[model samples]
Target: MTRRWTHGRSMRHSGAACGATSAQARITDEAHLVTCPDCPDAAEAEAIPDDATTGDPHLIETLRDARDGHTRKIDGVVVDATTAHAILTVYDAATPKTKAKIAVLPLTVMTSLAWNILRADVKREGPR
Candidate 1:
Protein backbone atom coordinates (compact mmCIF):
# COMPACT_ATOMS: atom_id res chain seq x y z
CA MET A 1 0.00 0.00 0.00
CA THR A 2 1.37 3.44 -0.97
CA ARG A 3 1.04 6.30 1.49
CA ARG A 4 0.76 9.96 0.49
CA TRP A 5 2.69 12.90 1.99
CA THR A 6 0.56 16.03 1.60
CA HIS A 7 1.62 19.35 3.12
CA GLY A 8 -0.63 21.82 1.28
CA ARG A 9 -2.98 21.05 -1.62
CA SER A 10 -0.29 19.17 -3.52
CA MET A 11 0.22 15.45 -3.04
CA ARG A 12 3.88 14.43 -2.66
CA HIS A 13 5.32 10.92 -2.86
CA SER A 14 2.84 8.10 -2.71
CA GLY A 15 5.21 5.60 -1.11
CA ALA A 16 7.20 6.98 1.87
CA ALA A 17 5.75 9.71 4.04
CA CYS A 18 8.52 12.22 4.87
CA GLY A 19 8.43 15.76 6.24
CA ALA A 20 11.45 17.03 4.30
CA THR A 21 11.23 18.24 0.69
CA SER A 22 12.69 16.31 -2.23
CA ALA A 23 15.95 18.28 -2.18
CA GLN A 24 16.42 17.73 1.52
CA ALA A 25 15.67 14.07 1.06
CA ARG A 26 18.32 13.92 -1.60
CA ILE A 27 20.83 15.74 0.54
CA THR A 28 20.12 13.45 3.49
CA ASP A 29 20.56 10.44 1.27
CA GLU A 30 23.86 11.77 -0.06
CA ALA A 31 25.05 12.83 3.36
CA HIS A 32 28.11 10.95 4.55
CA LEU A 33 27.98 8.76 7.62
CA VAL A 34 29.76 10.59 10.40
CA THR A 35 31.09 8.90 13.58
CA CYS A 36 30.65 5.58 11.74
CA PRO A 37 33.82 5.58 9.70
CA ASP A 38 34.10 1.79 9.50
CA CYS A 39 31.98 1.78 6.35
CA PRO A 40 34.79 1.52 3.84
CA ASP A 41 32.35 1.65 0.94
CA ALA A 42 31.05 5.07 1.93
CA ALA A 43 31.70 8.19 -0.13
CA GLU A 44 35.14 9.76 0.27
CA ALA A 45 34.35 13.33 -0.86
CA GLU A 46 31.32 14.20 1.24
CA ALA A 47 31.79 17.03 3.74
CA ILE A 48 30.44 17.16 7.32
CA PRO A 49 30.86 18.78 10.72
CA ASP A 50 33.79 18.19 13.06
CA ASP A 51 34.04 18.70 16.82
CA ALA A 52 35.10 22.35 16.76
CA THR A 53 36.00 25.35 14.64
CA THR A 54 39.63 26.42 13.98
CA GLY A 55 39.40 29.53 16.15
CA ASP A 56 37.79 27.69 19.08
CA PRO A 57 40.16 27.85 22.05
CA HIS A 58 39.69 24.19 22.80
CA LEU A 59 40.48 23.19 19.25
CA ILE A 60 43.94 24.74 19.33
CA GLU A 61 44.45 23.43 22.84
CA THR A 62 43.79 19.85 21.82
CA LEU A 63 46.56 20.09 19.23
CA ARG A 64 49.16 21.20 21.81
CA ASP A 65 47.61 19.95 25.06
CA ALA A 66 49.89 18.18 27.47
CA ARG A 67 50.22 14.95 25.53
CA ASP A 68 49.54 12.19 28.06
CA GLY A 69 49.91 14.63 30.97
CA HIS A 70 53.47 15.93 30.72
CA THR A 71 53.19 19.34 32.32
CA ARG A 72 54.32 22.21 30.09
CA LYS A 73 56.35 23.85 32.79
CA ILE A 74 57.91 27.25 32.10
CA ASP A 75 59.74 29.04 34.83
CA GLY A 76 57.85 31.74 36.76
CA VAL A 77 54.68 30.44 35.14
CA VAL A 78 51.97 29.04 37.38
CA VAL A 79 49.49 26.88 35.49
CA ASP A 80 46.12 26.45 37.08
CA ALA A 81 43.08 24.69 35.62
CA THR A 82 40.04 25.49 37.77
CA THR A 83 37.58 23.53 35.67
CA ALA A 84 36.82 19.83 35.94
CA HIS A 85 39.14 19.12 33.04
CA ALA A 86 42.79 20.23 32.99
CA ILE A 87 44.25 22.80 30.60
CA LEU A 88 47.71 23.47 29.22
CA THR A 89 49.47 26.79 28.94
CA VAL A 90 51.30 27.96 25.84
CA TYR A 91 53.93 30.68 25.96
CA ASP A 92 54.18 33.20 23.14
CA ALA A 93 57.41 33.79 21.27
CA ALA A 94 56.22 37.28 20.39
CA THR A 95 55.34 38.14 23.98
CA PRO A 96 57.51 36.63 26.69
CA LYS A 97 55.12 37.85 29.41
CA THR A 98 51.88 36.39 28.00
CA LYS A 99 50.40 32.89 28.29
CA ALA A 100 47.43 31.07 26.76
CA LYS A 101 45.45 28.60 28.83
CA ILE A 102 44.32 25.86 26.54
CA ALA A 103 41.81 23.64 28.25
CA VAL A 104 40.99 19.94 27.96
CA LEU A 105 38.24 19.31 25.43
CA PRO A 106 35.09 17.26 25.27
CA LEU A 107 34.69 14.40 22.83
CA THR A 108 31.42 15.30 21.14
CA VAL A 109 31.80 14.15 17.56
CA MET A 110 34.24 11.23 17.75
CA THR A 111 33.25 7.63 17.14
CA SER A 112 32.87 5.33 20.11
CA LEU A 113 36.20 3.62 19.52
CA ALA A 114 38.06 6.89 19.04
CA TRP A 115 36.53 8.35 22.20
CA ASN A 116 37.57 5.23 24.11
CA ILE A 117 41.10 5.53 22.86
CA LEU A 118 41.23 9.18 23.93
CA ARG A 119 39.89 8.40 27.39
CA ALA A 120 41.99 5.31 27.95
CA ASP A 121 45.64 5.64 28.88
CA VAL A 122 46.82 2.08 28.39
CA LYS A 123 50.55 1.78 27.56
CA ARG A 124 50.52 5.45 28.48
CA GLU A 125 53.31 7.97 28.24
CA GLY A 126 54.23 11.11 30.22
CA PRO A 127 52.48 12.03 33.47
CA ARG A 128 51.28 9.49 36.02
Candidate 2:
Protein backbone atom coordinates (compact mmCIF):
# COMPACT_ATOMS: atom_id res chain seq x y z
CA MET A 1 0.00 0.00 0.00
CA THR A 2 1.07 3.63 -0.73
CA ARG A 3 0.50 6.66 1.50
CA ARG A 4 -0.07 10.28 0.36
CA TRP A 5 1.63 13.14 2.23
CA THR A 6 0.35 16.70 2.81
CA HIS A 7 2.50 19.85 3.17
CA GLY A 8 1.86 20.26 6.97
CA ARG A 9 2.26 16.51 7.57
CA SER A 10 5.52 16.49 5.60
CA MET A 11 6.78 19.47 7.65
CA ARG A 12 5.87 17.59 10.87
CA HIS A 13 7.69 14.47 9.62
CA SER A 14 10.80 16.63 9.05
CA GLY A 15 10.92 17.38 12.84
CA ALA A 16 10.72 21.17 12.31
CA ALA A 17 7.67 22.22 14.34
CA CYS A 18 8.94 25.84 14.61
CA GLY A 19 6.62 26.71 11.61
CA ALA A 20 7.44 26.91 7.88
CA THR A 21 6.52 30.53 7.14
CA SER A 22 10.02 31.39 5.84
CA ALA A 23 11.74 27.99 5.88
CA GLN A 24 13.22 25.94 3.01
CA ALA A 25 12.50 22.22 3.01
CA ARG A 26 14.83 19.63 1.41
CA ILE A 27 14.46 15.87 1.05
CA THR A 28 17.56 13.67 1.39
CA ASP A 29 18.01 9.90 1.14
CA GLU A 30 18.23 9.60 4.93
CA ALA A 31 15.81 12.30 6.13
CA HIS A 32 14.03 15.59 5.36
CA LEU A 33 15.70 18.83 6.50
CA VAL A 34 14.07 22.23 6.99
CA THR A 35 16.27 25.35 7.39
CA CYS A 36 15.23 28.95 8.03
CA PRO A 37 17.70 31.68 7.08
CA ASP A 38 16.09 34.30 9.36
CA CYS A 39 16.03 32.09 12.48
CA PRO A 40 18.94 32.18 14.91
CA ASP A 41 20.83 28.96 15.54
CA ALA A 42 19.70 26.98 18.61
CA ALA A 43 23.10 27.32 20.35
CA GLU A 44 23.43 31.05 19.63
CA ALA A 45 19.91 32.15 20.67
CA GLU A 46 20.12 33.80 24.11
CA ALA A 47 17.12 35.18 26.04
CA ILE A 48 17.69 38.69 27.40
CA PRO A 49 15.35 40.15 30.05
CA ASP A 50 13.30 43.26 29.15
CA ASP A 51 14.90 45.16 32.07
CA ALA A 52 18.52 44.32 31.09
CA THR A 53 20.83 47.35 31.11
CA THR A 54 22.71 47.79 27.83
CA GLY A 55 24.69 50.79 29.08
CA ASP A 56 24.76 51.61 32.79
CA PRO A 57 25.17 55.32 33.65
CA HIS A 58 26.96 54.52 36.93
CA LEU A 59 29.46 52.23 35.17
CA ILE A 60 30.19 54.94 32.55
CA GLU A 61 30.69 57.57 35.25
CA THR A 62 33.02 55.27 37.23
CA LEU A 63 35.11 54.55 34.11
CA ARG A 64 35.40 58.30 33.35
CA ASP A 65 36.48 59.02 36.96
CA ALA A 66 39.07 56.26 36.84
CA ARG A 67 40.45 57.63 33.56
CA ASP A 68 40.59 61.19 34.95
CA GLY A 69 42.37 60.01 38.12
CA HIS A 70 45.07 58.20 36.09
CA THR A 71 48.44 60.04 36.27
CA ARG A 72 50.85 59.47 33.38
CA LYS A 73 54.52 59.17 34.50
CA ILE A 74 57.79 58.44 32.74
CA ASP A 75 60.88 57.30 34.75
CA GLY A 76 59.25 58.47 38.06
CA VAL A 77 58.57 62.03 36.77
CA VAL A 78 54.98 63.18 36.18
CA VAL A 79 54.32 64.09 32.49
CA ASP A 80 51.61 66.63 33.35
CA ALA A 81 53.76 68.54 35.89
CA THR A 82 57.38 68.72 34.68
CA THR A 83 56.92 68.15 30.92
CA ALA A 84 53.81 70.30 30.77
CA HIS A 85 55.54 73.21 32.57
CA ALA A 86 58.58 73.11 30.27
CA ILE A 87 56.41 72.90 27.12
CA LEU A 88 54.18 75.74 28.27
CA THR A 89 57.16 77.93 29.18
CA VAL A 90 58.83 77.36 25.82
CA TYR A 91 55.53 77.75 23.94
CA ASP A 92 54.92 81.12 25.62
CA ALA A 93 58.42 82.39 24.64
CA ALA A 94 58.44 80.88 21.10
CA THR A 95 57.59 82.61 17.79
CA PRO A 96 54.41 81.50 15.96
CA LYS A 97 56.20 79.06 13.57
CA THR A 98 58.39 77.60 16.36
CA LYS A 99 55.33 77.29 18.63
CA ALA A 100 53.55 75.23 15.96
CA LYS A 101 56.60 72.95 15.67
CA ILE A 102 56.76 72.47 19.48
CA ALA A 103 53.10 71.45 19.59
CA VAL A 104 53.74 68.14 17.72
CA LEU A 105 56.81 66.76 19.65
CA PRO A 106 56.46 63.00 20.28
CA LEU A 107 55.86 61.71 23.83
CA THR A 108 59.37 60.13 24.07
CA VAL A 109 61.12 63.43 23.27
CA MET A 110 58.76 65.32 25.61
CA THR A 111 59.56 62.85 28.43
CA SER A 112 63.29 63.25 27.76
CA LEU A 113 62.94 67.04 27.96
CA ALA A 114 61.05 66.62 31.25
CA TRP A 115 63.81 64.36 32.63
CA ASN A 116 66.47 66.94 31.66
CA ILE A 117 64.46 69.85 33.13
CA LEU A 118 63.95 67.99 36.45
CA ARG A 119 67.70 67.25 36.59
CA ALA A 120 68.58 70.97 35.95
CA ASP A 121 70.50 69.91 32.83
CA VAL A 122 68.29 72.08 30.57
CA LYS A 123 68.79 75.81 31.18
CA ARG A 124 66.07 78.42 30.51
CA GLU A 125 67.41 81.80 29.28
CA GLY A 126 65.57 85.17 29.23
CA PRO A 127 63.04 85.68 26.38
CA ARG A 128 64.68 86.78 23.09
Q: Give the winner by lDDT.
A: 2
User: Model 1, 128: alpha-carbon shift in Å?
Assistant: 44
| Tens digits of per-residue lDDT for model 2, 24-97 | 34222222242444323321221111211223323222222323553333222223443455555555666889
Q: In candidate 2, which residue pairs get closer than 3 Å at backbone N, Cα or C atoms, i.e. clash?
A: none
lDDT of 2 at 97: 98
Which run of 10 residues does model 1 get worst, by summed lDDT? 75-84
Query: What's the true lDDT of residue 10 in model 1?
Result: 16
Model 1, residue 13: what's the lDDT? Answer: 36
Candidate 1 lDDT over residue span 1-128, tens digit each: 33222222112233222233443332223224222232221222112123344235554353344344433222112122321122221222213333222222232222233334444644466467
Candidate 2: C-alpha lDDT: 0.38
Can you tell me which runs of candidate 2 are displaced by over 4 Å? 1-78, 111-128
Q: Report the C-alpha displacement of residue 89, candidate 1, in angstroms.
A: 15
Instruction: Judge candidate 1 at residue 111 and give its lDDT.
Output: 22
